[model samples]
Target: MKKKRSIISLCLSALFSLMLLFTSFVKPVNAAPTITLEQTFTATANPDVVGKWSEVERLRVNDTNITQELFITDNEHKTSTIVKGFGNDASPNSQLFLLHKFAGWNTATKPYPVLFVHGAGSDGDFAVDPERNGTTPGLAQSLAADGYAVFAITFAHPHGDNYIQREVLAAAIQRIKDITGKTKVDLIAHSKGNMSSRMYVSDVKKSWGTAFRNDVRRYIQLGAPNGGIDYTFRNTWAAWGIMATGAFGPVPYTYMTIYGWPTDTAYHSIYSAADGGGAYPGQAQMLARWDNVYDLDIFEQDWYTTYYGGWGYYSYSEGIDYAINQGGNLINTLKNTPVKSTVQLATLAGSENVINGVVMEDDGPSDGVVFIASATMTDPMISGGATLLEKKVLPINHVQLAYDPTALTWIKTQLSR
Candidate 1:
């Protein structure tokens, strides 16, 4: 009897402990930290948005093949250049390449070079296929070849708003800045890279104070999600959402963004240079605009937001808890999101395979991996990542925004400023 009682007590204690642990890492409340509702805020997207946005398909023969070839001439006005890079992959033995372009190489009044942050699931390498119709290899390389130095940045793994990936991105940016002596760099980040770029720059300021802010001349985030995204499918949403609301809990870095919905805690705080897709009252207005497939609606249903203390908008369900309970392999829900139905066709419609010189497989969706919403920015610029000038948006995807011809025209207009 005594032994049975002891074992029973032990079992009860263990159960209690597990319960406490789960409760400790609950989801955050849906209330905004700070909110300035622009009752006038309306969607400015066009109806022809369908015509402009392309479809993505799957990969073909050239999609996975690796290559390394030398250039024949010194055509400085090149749009893009591809080479191998450092990273690992899921395949047994796989390798990847890096892409770069030097913009404004010789111009005296050259605008500070802007690094293109491609979307998720893809590196800077366009040698394979263009998941999105707007990835302009010609214009990007030409910008580099023409005089402006341009580089398309890619991480070893997926990192679309996922916590650890952001850290790696921060380190990656620093390394790039170190390699290139250009004092002030202009960043043009797409999709998840936008958030990653913002976090890195913010870290530079926090770690070294505002001194580093000057090192950034201009910062543009294309297809950025100011609010929480469609958290429906992923089990990791609840926990990550909780960590993202505050200054830096799960991500452990500064968040330069504006939440779009009242339910999102980020909507409460406007840490980004621009809030909700328009010019700031202070400076840098008049940027062009872009759009993504879905809004922040998929994950709209309320759950038992643990932090809120009950069944609320940000609750942690058994699904999420099971995924991350008792210290799991912290999955990056942001980057690994499956291809959403809305934008699936557009991501792969037109890409051709470089190898065997035939049409490649349709890419499906993604600049590489991150979704369309996370890559959009409907706002203007402010005083944070350097300069107090007007802001503008270009009708392009995240990566394409940096090097697309139309976007380049808009950038040149900014340069004249």
Candidate 2:
């Protein structure tokens, strides 16, 4: 009996030894440190600047030192001007990219952190936390309330080059990973913001830019012009209205000749520059005509001349074709570049034509600014390991995709999955 017991005990000991050996071979997950928001705030350089970040405050969260507001300097472009309505500061300092982190990072319950990329003519603050007319919370706020880590980035120029913006995005993702101890993050981009996000994921880069490091787990684009957009060129009258309201940045073509205003040489006109370099390379990158699929808005003044390149009673346009050429015709490049198959992609398009109570783009199905076809296009990302998780069209407008309650709900659902 004693010999039999000894044999059983030896077998148990060997099994225990094998378990330890197996565990040693397995890698340990880098768990997040147990840090509370209060503990994090105690380490802040400027604790007084809570809620909104001042230019000087910095915070140390989870042993990662970060500024309350971070900046990305474009080493390539030494000078850049912010669009009129986006910001007033065009100083050398303002040319740097901007980043924002909403409160409640330490208390986040989500597995992955979310990074918000604002569209053209917008910033991090306005993109995620606009002053809404109703009680519905902004998209970032909603995500934060649900205990999700939320961060946002604003480009140096509202109309900055997409190549530079994509590089900046790579930096932002690395920074978020450093702060949260998460290797991968999810990107939420809107309109033109999708250009840089797609560029990063697709590994479409400039010589100096960083290639895709496979750091993004999921990408959600809202009202993106995936197939490209020619709204301004298709409806020439819209340019006059946009410039008059001072809403969007400079249009690709100058209309001062028609409006009797002095022509601003600094305007981002395709005619004045080669490859759309003088100003607003980002805007130039998002140019593609859908005239083959849909007709130009006939009601718009000089639609024929504006689209076909001619002098009309209302305006003189070099034509949509010329604008696309001068703009680098990046849509072709983007369409050819497939997103890495590993990342999951989803897109949302707004079908509503009214934005901020103004009627726009009534000619076909559009989010006032982006057509449904352009917004929902996923053909470019299918070839690679990238999977199209879903494509949804909501009843919101282009601007509302950032803050509307319905859109926010859909975004939350996607994030949950």
Candidate 3:
């Protein structure tokens, strides 16, 4: 009995020491970074005018940072009910596609509230702000006009290397809850948008508890790089190299990113649930009936990856994909994003490590900028929530999935649950 007591005391001491170490490491983790945007009041620049030129080279080469066109006075979150300049004027030739039923023509039935999410490196202007080279017939404005009260929020800033968009989205969700007082809301997100929603749901579940989960009912992932994408290649060799580069890209201090990649949790959970046996049975049901997109008509297993680069050395699928994803074609404003080949990576390793389908030239499946399998997530089941709500196959590419007609009906069906 004396010996047992001594052993228990030693164990207690060791446990206390470990707890102290853990708290020390955790101090920095809990604090999120705050970004502040500042612009000179006298200064004025128009992104529309500045964007007319790909002066990145000139700006960097000459160090000519003085702007003739700075954003014409900081437009502080323009929130108006009937935004004349912001909303689109229905054109004589404006054609709404594939909406003859459910959404279009039938004006009596209350059209479900639709949420529009922009991807990384983009602003809400892409959906609403016309002056920011913004698109007309924005999804939020149109859906709200049809019936549903819409919510639109952009990331605090334009771009980031990680999924910082999740926090902005979380704030948006909170704002949405405050306004509607509804039990559930519908969501549609594109690119990192899909993953951002996952992070919002997963993190809220883990950090805040399950109460807020009820506020968001259905999640629709449009043209999502759900699994980390491999921009290089899908082969085994290319994957290792991409991982080496991405890992070396930035030193991570937080587990906020799904794996190290921002948009990997849902994608990883989908694949893991599909393959992992009897591992958390709850997730198996949640992630069931998700979509994995593939353009089989174009190419097969290994060979399909090559087609993304296309036949030409100067193909749009090659170098320009990253360019479009990072920043749209500076020259051609109307370049339709045609992202193909949602190739699955071979395998995953490490605890937080996952195999994302993203790849680059001469590289394999990636993590956002890399391949799918290579990307990892913190808690996958929470990332995807109760459903993946995805888009795949014919008439579906990364860009087209954003407001795809098929995804609309499906989103409504899911939310009704």
Best by lDDT: 2
lDDT of 1 by residue, 1-417 (tens): 999999999999999999999989995432211111111111133212111112111111121222221111121112221111231122111112222333333342455655666644444543122433454354345455446656554443332223333343333344445556566666665544554555444432122221223355555554444222222222124234533443211210122222433243322211121322111110011011111333222343332332112234433222223212211222232222322111100011101112222111112222322233333322221222233333343334344544556655655454334
The predicted structure with the larger TM-score, 1 or 2, is 2
Question: Per-residue CA lDDT of candidate 2, range 242-270, in tens?
Answer: 55665454444554453676554235453
The worst-scoring run of ten residues by lDDT in candidate 1 lies at 278-287
Candidate 1 regions off by >4 Å? 1-84, 87-111, 126-139, 160-179, 204-213, 231-404
Rank ordering of all candidates by TM-score, starting from the highest: 2, 1, 3
**For each candidate, what TM-score against the reference?**
0.40, 0.77, 0.39
Candidate that would win on TM-score: 2
Model 3 spans with C-alpha error above 4 angstroms = 1-113, 128-136, 161-163, 204-214, 232-392, 404-417
Deviation in Å, model 1, residue 276 alpha carbon: 35
TM-score of candidate 2 versus the correct structure, residues matched by position:
0.77
What lDDT would each prediction earn against the true structure? 0.33, 0.69, 0.33
Clash count, candidate 2: 3
- In candidate 3 the C-alpha lDDT for residue 170 amounts to 49
